[model samples]
Target chain A: MSSKNLIIVPIFNEAWNLPLLFERLGALKKSWDVLYINDGSSDSSKELLEAQGSNFIDLAYNIGIGGCVQTGLKYAFEHEYDYAVQLDGDGQHPIEALSELLEEVNSNECDIAIGSRFKRDKKHPVGRTRRLGIRILSSTIKVLTGQTILDPTSGYRLFNRKSISLLSENYPQDYPEPESVVFLLKNGLRICEVPVRMNSREGGISSIHRDGIFYMAKVMLSMIMVVLRPKESSHGSR
Target chain B: MEADNLVDINRVQYIAIAVSVVYLLAILYLIRGKKIREEYSLIWLLFGVVFIVLSIWREGLDWISNLLGVAYPPTAIFLIFFMAIFLIMIQFSLIISRLSRNNSKLAQDQALIKQKLEQVEKKLSEK
Candidate 1:
């Protein structure tokens, strides 16, 4: 087991999937430690994260995906882990992709590796509208940061120490995925992607509300605003 | 206008003004905090002062209300009260949102501290 290998999972009200998520994660037991940071969920997700008996950090409140992931990254950085992989609790992310990410991190000097389901299988289940939305954001991220990313919205990613340090300090508060990609690239970190298959959500409803389509427009506009804004350095006094 | 009732109304107006002045002083005392609670109180205080002035200036009150097309003084007062209440409710919602955040955070912190203590105790026992 490598000393610095880590997988950080952020959980929020995904109690139904926690048991299976933990089982699959435990089966992989390839010397990687799992850290689940439970967002302020009213459900038993907190109890499940605690019961799973893995290392975790409990957030103060519902800080959304951006803040939850940031909390996990901060823990990883403070504890000096070499790499951190973020897997979703909703069971859509593939655990097998962990290998591909590790390979990239080890063989290549890549700072971050993302799992691109759409590019991988060409059968990703995202609706047409969503595909369009994601593309606009992906291309926008590319233009803003001069970095090409296939899946800017992927929650499944592996970050090395440098990437982790960069994100832990400066993360977007709103629709964080596309905005975060820009942030990473603007800070001079290279991002690469590996194809990984993802399944539809196994349990619990998607957090995207009935007005989620509307949310995409809002996210798109906000991402544009974020890209337009200037970024401060990681070492700069925040 | 009945003479006795006019005297009673005048007395009530004076008392109301006095109360409003005291409220204004109290709001000034704690405006530094400027929190939701204080803001709510400030709204009430301002309304009190406004109501006091309107009550004393009967013709002026009627003129403003009539200009606004509200016939009844109580109706105008009710309308303002409802609007102020709406603003206060919004403030209440904000406070609830903050309270929920504090509750979740304080509980998580407590749990973390307790978990660390248990880990310490387990290590001591193992040693």
Candidate 2:
């Protein structure tokens, strides 16, 4: 049977970028369906998304990035989507990487495929502090799970049916990307990273960019907690 | 001599007992007025009862202070009060977190329902 793919774009106050994002995604060659999750934007993002006439889930309030993405996953799970890809609405994640990510998951090579900026072409120049934070998290995951994930903080990810069910049920709320990698690894789920070109943000600032130090500290603490927490035995989809 | 010192209740102890009684009355009034949920106010009530108990039985406070190696008996009361407040704050934070999660889930569910309803309405109009 052919797999059904759902591209989940979690947006928060990215009205300016939506037009270009919609254009780029619309031009994709694959027949994957798109679902946008509006994370309670104060701007006219909801109206703009509605005008697009695509599938979308509107959150009542700003529940942060993790909650917004998890809502998309829950929608995919309930709708019985075979595979779901989490794409950012900021236009930073290139639509070209979608094919490679979906191909990895479709071939059963890995249950979750991550688009890494550092894999092959290191074109995206990251700030020093943010780069250090990413390094710390990546190293922590390696030490704990014996797996090397190049970009643990990347939002560009594809999840198979099993991962969708598991994450939809229980996902980390704050700073979920790295903690989720640890959780998936501890549960014996296969993860692979594919090299992808990431563009600079076209509009809006990152929610975590303001408090870099504090955010890094919290992420480090969360990584420790993820490792210390007891393991789950069930690996299959519920 | 120490035993007598423990049994002796001073003016400060009387003031404490009076304050505890007033606090307990306020909690009861709030509960009666339906301003505070019973489940949430239970901890406050328990704290008020503990304060009254400690004020009435001065000897018990001294015993506890000595057992815990605290130099001053009043320090023991302050320690317990702060500990209780900290615990109550933690409980409230946990409740807020759970409520936020449920709120987000409800919003997501509502969005899904709205989407399905729209689809059905569109189909009906087409037919």
Candidate 3:
């Protein structure tokens, strides 16, 4: 039996990139379900999404990336989907990598599979500050959990039903990607990183560019908090 | 002259008393007008009362300041004011964090309900 997989694409003011994203995902050979989460966009993003007649959830207001993704997970949990794949709406995470992420998750090798840009041999140009921030987060996760996450900040990921349920109940808020990695590791959830190439965003501003130092500090603080947080008793259970 | 000698009434003390009265009146007005919830207004009311008491009892303020080892009594007023402000700020932060968390939960619940309703509506229409 084919696994019930739902693709969650959380969008925020990416009206321009919607058409191209639709085209790329539409070209996929596999018939996968996609849910577009409109994160309280003031732009014509909702109108564009409506025009496509795609399934989507319109949040009342912007609640950041974590809230958006958690909403999708809630949907997946309610609908009883076996697996959920998170794909960014900005087109940075390549649509072609979806299959590899799904394959890993479906194989039952890991409860969650992340698409790591740093795992590949090819060099992706990154800003010095961002590279340093990423390195700090990567090392922090490594030191705390003893698990090396090559791309702790990667938004592209696939979560099995157990993770979907767990995260649906409780998930991080702002800058959640790395912090969530630590949370999952602390909870003893199996994680695997698959090498994937990422394209520079087609359009729209990157969320990380707004507050460089403050964002980094918050992320580091969140990581430390996650490390110190007591393990949940119901962890690793269906 | 006896009462005047007993209380060291000064311009700063008068100003502090006036400010405290105004703050207390403002808080009462807000509560009466339903602008601020009664539960939250309690803290402001308490602050207003403390200010009023400290303004009226100069010697008491000095005694507390001396006990705290603060060199200047007026500086104690400023210090207490700042501490109250800081505590209020922390309270606001906590309230906002809770509100945002609930807001997100409400959004998620609403989205799930809407999706389910749409599905049911579609199924009914097909039948």
DockQ for every prediction shown: 0.13, 0.49, 0.61
On the 0 to 100 scale, the lDDT of residue A58 in model 2 is 82
Which runs of model 2 end up more than 4 angstroms from their true locations? A235-238, B1-11
Please give, for every candidate in the order listed, the TM-score of chain B alone compared with the true chain B: 0.67, 0.82, 0.87
TM-score of each: 0.70, 0.90, 0.93
Higher-lDDT candidate of 1 and 3: 3
Worst 10 residues of 3 chain A by lDDT: A229-238
Worst 10 residues of 1 chain B by lDDT: B104-113
Q: Considering only chain A, what is the TM-score of each predicted structure?
A: 0.90, 0.93, 0.94
In the predicted model 2, the residue pairs found to clash are none
Cα lDDT tens digits, model 2, A56-162, are 77888888888889988888998899889999998888888888998877676799999998899665687776777788888988898898998999989999998
lDDT of 1 at B123: 88
Q: Provide the overall lDDT of each model, using Cα atoms, as 2-decimal numbers.
A: 0.75, 0.86, 0.87
Task: Fill in the DockQ of model 1.
Answer: 0.13
Candidate 1 structure quality by residue, lDDT tens digits, A148-170: 78788788899999888888776
Tens digit of lDDT per residue, candidate 3, span B1-127? 7877877659778998999999999999999999999988888999999999998888989898998899988889888989999999999999999999999888877876887788799899999
Interface RMSDs of the predictions, in order, are 4.4, 1.5, 1.1
True contacts kept of 3: 0.42
Q: CA shift at B36, candidate 2, in angstroms?
A: 2.8
